[model samples]
Target: MSGQGWERRHAAEYGTTAWSRAVVSCGALVAHHAGYDRRPGAVSEAAAGFRQEWMPVAELLALAACRAGQAQDRPVDDVELPVLLGWADGAHTHLLHTGPLDGHLGPAHWLRLAEDETCRSRARDVVTTESTLAIVESRELTGGRTSTPARALRLGARAAAAQARGVGFPAWADDCAWAADQVERLHLAMQAGAWRPTSAHRAYAREVHRTLVAEPDHPPCPAGAVGPSWIQRVVRIPHVRATVLALAAQPAYAVAAPASDPLGAAVDAVVHVGMEPVSVLAAGLERAWAAQLPDRPVAEWELAHIPGPVREQIRAVEALALRLTVVLLDLWHPHE
Candidate 1:
């Protein structure tokens, strides 16, 4: 591969331990053929993820093995191959387009695996050459990012729970948009005057029911658009703050929201909007985009989203997604 090509390929392969294992497997096979098992640091070095500098050597050795008939190189169509391919395609789609906040936990799991020297050494033994000493010992298989498996698992579980709640950005944005609409409707209901008397309360309840019937039950705005683009539109809406504050503010909320639970469904809906992960993502993107503007100074997370190298871009997107969740959650429910 050309220097640029190798760089791009490495960028794609780096930080994903599965690919590292594949490369190491190639290295191991080459070691078996060349008697590198007898060498002192062979196994440990290969296990450490085979340095970038060693990649060309590994590739050349692998090719030579295949040419010499020592390593059989052929494509086999397994029954499960199609199913696996479909899943991989779907996962990529979900990650980049449909559900960016979900299922990028592979790196974390790999990092854990990298730490287990015993298991790795045992696996190497299982695939060892005739003489038995292995030629692959490597560390930091999943790049330099320090992701705890337990923490990654928690985040993955949360993201999965959020998935059960709804699909990507559109689904979440629709809820918020609908909630804002509810707030507007409630504001309109209270606009005439305060309903102090029992009869006035009844009349107010009737009005709420009528409005509820007139408006669609489901979210109206989101038409399946995903990610920051759709949410940017939502953040740009002029009346969002005013509408949210209509229900969130003290006196207005107290007087406007009905006493009975059914009559106060609008308030409930707004609260539900706050609970969804997608809403949090939207809020985070709002803040990030704001920082991107010339007047607003860019923060570290904000700068990550800027166009750059493939590896940098991938890291940036992941960081932004993670940071967004944190920031939005804090803003949604800031604690003392």
Candidate 2:
């Protein structure tokens, strides 16, 4: 709980290990904006259990958090298991790999500077140059079409890294036109049925759907899934409905209705991060897809359109996402 040590350790390991690598990898994947790492096993077992009928969405989220944060350490403490930090750290990729620092990096590609303390200064130069190289490669891949926020973040992160390395900061461009462009695109997409999740998001939703259908009648946890130190949490239908209403009540998002894609809420969450939060929309869309695993058509999925019980079971994912951002920047964020 001592943030002092946590900060030192996080800075010590930031982008210097498997966890940081995963962050950059995920970030690059997301910064590309439209594609996912759809190769088989792209969704690791670590990312699995998203819709396990027995596990609460909260726990499934916690487990994945444990895995991502655990990259700094891979397992969550008993008391701190619920919050996830992958979102914030994952965003580091935008800073590390976009613009002039881009690269075809992923979790598997391991790159580290010399570890000798005597070589610390030289090591930093290596990191800044490497970060720059990654940016260069990413720009090459994107054909010089990097967005505004993406460019700013990559430069900012690299400069931060250079500062950490005891080097001078590099000057960067001030063109940030892309954030507005993205927000506009989102609105246009919504008009064209973009708020809804595509078919790809269905698999995760199906699991949550089954869990809702079987709950209240059957036991909370299925056979063998239950264990000590576990508390059963059956989400209440009315409470969930109220929370959704509250979100819609004072939202900065355009889609306030339940049937509206969680994309709107996700973009709202990004505004809080102060960077290009729209990138997080990809993850939100996947979650929204899960929440909408209704037994009927989405057009009829207005809050009232959903069954009370299932609606309770299928909750908004932005709450978890925003919470994860906090966990990343606050709890697990090494900067403390």
Candidate 3:
């Protein structure tokens, strides 16, 4: 690799443990075979995520690492071939926008894989679909920023997660984009409005729900949207401060979000928007777009949609969704 400062500092640490060494070796092998030699710390950077993997995936990593070492190969072995192709496909998309982007893999590597008759048939089926999906997703995460370390890291995560389970992002992604944007803007406004000596917290709370409340200047006509009286009953409404975090949690009280639960879509919205850790929210978002698990409970659960620890936070989000729903109802109801 490029002997970047980060690699120099952490490379020795890779030698400190079998697991760490495996990650570095594997990451480096992939980085090397894929032409990332000029890029400093590529292997070590990819290595950081190896901690949470299981043995089967680890075995694949070992194979990938070794394969990269020899012929300095393109792609990886057949154990998790689908995931590897996906990993490369997803990783390459996001890496393109990050800094020192010069030394990374690209379409050429995927093309070589297609040439292999064994993987060829399958590759032909999904390559175009996944690659196009990755491009759109990576762009959203990075946005216009040339240096989003978090978004950049997502490239590897999507790849690894794919390798582990042969899946990409969740299906309800685009549906949640507006809510995520709203929450993010609210988060910033809360931070900036903190200077009010006495009621900064209350002010923050009001600002958090101001749009829903239809406050002066932010008003959007209450008569058109659902009435907010029921939801505003909770006195201690929390800010968008994410106390509980999950990559994505299926909070549906009933399977497929029971018909009576008007806010099931809302719950799905906030959950998929990812209530905590912005990086997770931004990562795999594209995969979610490409995937569509209409009513599959196992698929939903395996997608890692719920962060079980933050039960209260999730309930809070659900309540807020109720409140927000009223706002939308009022906006659209004109006669309400």
Q: Quote each prediction's TM-score.
A: 0.25, 0.19, 0.25
- The candidates, ranked best first by TM-score, are 3, 1, 2
Model 3 misplaced stretches (Cα beyond 4 Å): 1-54, 62-157, 160-204, 210-273, 280-336
On TM-score, who's better, 1 or 2?
1
Per-residue CA lDDT of candidate 2, range 1-336, in tens?
233343344344342333333344322222222122223334455334322321222222222332434444321211111122222223222222112112233223211111122222322333334344445544543466752222222222232222222212111111112223333454455457654544322332232223323323211233444321011121222222234344445534223332344433333332322222222222322233344444633322221122222122222222333332332222112241
- Prediction 1 TM-score vs. true: 0.25
Give candidate 3's TM-score.
Answer: 0.25
Give lDDT for model 3: 0.32
Model 1: residues >4 Å from true position, as ranges?
1-112, 115-229, 236-242, 246-253, 258-261, 274-278, 291-336
1-336: candidate 1 lDDT, tens digit per residue? 333343344334333222232334344333333334323323565544434333333333222222221111111100111122222222221221221111233434433433444433332332232112111100122242433222111111122222222222222344455555654554444444341224433443343333322312121223443323322333322123234444334443344353443225444444444333334344434543453434432222222222112122223223332332333233223355
Prediction-by-prediction clash tally: 12, 11, 17
What is the lDDT, from 0 to 100, of the residue 290 in candidate 2? 47
Best by lDDT: 3
> On a 0 to 100 scale, what is the lDDT of residue 314 in model 3?
33
